[model samples]
Target: MSLQWTIIATFLYAEIAFVLLLTLPIASPARWNKFFKSKFLAYISGQASIYFVVLIGVLILCLLDAIREMQKYSNIESTDHQHLDAEMQGNMRLFRAQRNFYISGIALFLLVVIRRLIQMICELAGLYAQSEANFRQAQSATVAAKTLLEKQGAGDEVAKKDIEDLRGQILLLEKELAKEKKDKEAVKSQAESLNREYDRLTEEHSKLQKKITIAGGDKKDN
Candidate 1:
């Protein structure tokens, strides 16, 4: 109740609040759900550390100020030193401080969350590979099935014709696959080349536009 004790209490509570802020929004099932893997959370942890360090720097300054105040009044032995008490009371608990820290920590988490989202995007890249793998497996199975069918009807003219038909179909499939591969490569290459040319032309056009503007301005001034 005395002034000295009140100041001390304020300082003590504020420090406590700061600490609580760092630890809030603790690890939870929902937090884990936010990220698909441990690495994502780990990245967030690193950012949280940075934010804590920064925010903590301010809190530390407050602490140092509290200490400086103590020193300023240290010589005043006869004074009640009640200000220290008020500071202690104000700085002791950190529930309020923790709220802001948690907010910053969550914002930093978004940086890592974006990285995770990118990884999710990269995962889609494997779809093309999986499709190719499936196609190969299916082709292999088809050949196996055709082989079995031919073996069962060996020496029959009708079976020979069926095998030849299957072979022709398989050849067609192989050709189509090759064509698609060629087309994909060609398109990709063309796109890259076109992009390069577009960039160059755009730069040139920008320069030309600047020159035209300058020339027109001179004529108008004349």
Candidate 2:
């Protein structure tokens, strides 16, 4: 093979290796994202568009050349039937042309495939990051809700305790009020009995004074 064909063959092999590595499950999406974002890859990516166009142009030219060679050799082999040596040479050349055609064609196809694979990997990485962020937000919200519920529960317990204390105080006040009523009734009954005794003594003293006056008047007359 010529030096140029040899280089193209090497590039094709490299492309195959890249495809295999890309499809393997050796690295996660995050790791692939990191690798793609690295400084070296970033620098390469800056010029990747230009590089891709140039490489495609080269491949197309090589494919065209291979096709022309294949047609030329096929014609020669068919027309020059009497010259066996020339026919053999043409056959060999045609075989090389066909080989080059397959190589360039496959390389071009793989190039596009690799680009698409990279894009898919990038999109997958973005989705993974977004999902992780959403999961973290959900966890934080759950924690916050739990904390709020706990606080409300504590407040409810405090309110219940206060109500119980107020109820106990009310019961004590009612008992005190009942005791005060009993004391007032006892004092009222004692005052009524003292008033009755005073009336009876006054009536007896008046009757005794009237009897003495009558007896003295009779003695004076005798």
User: Tell me, what's the RMSD of every candidate?
Assistant: 43.0, 2.5
Full-model lDDT for every candidate: 0.60, 0.92
Residue-level lDDT of model 1, residues 1-222, one tens digit each, is: 345434444544555554454336554323434443468666776686677567556545544544554454443434555687664543442332333334334434443454454454346435655777999999999999999888776758777898999999999999999999999999999999999999999999999999999999999999
- Candidate 1 off by > 4 Å: 1-157, 218-222
Which candidate number would show the highest TM-score if scored against the true structure?
2
Clash count per candidate: 40, 0
Q: Please give the distance, in angstroms, between residue 190's alpha carbon in candidate 1 and its true position after superposition.
A: 2.3
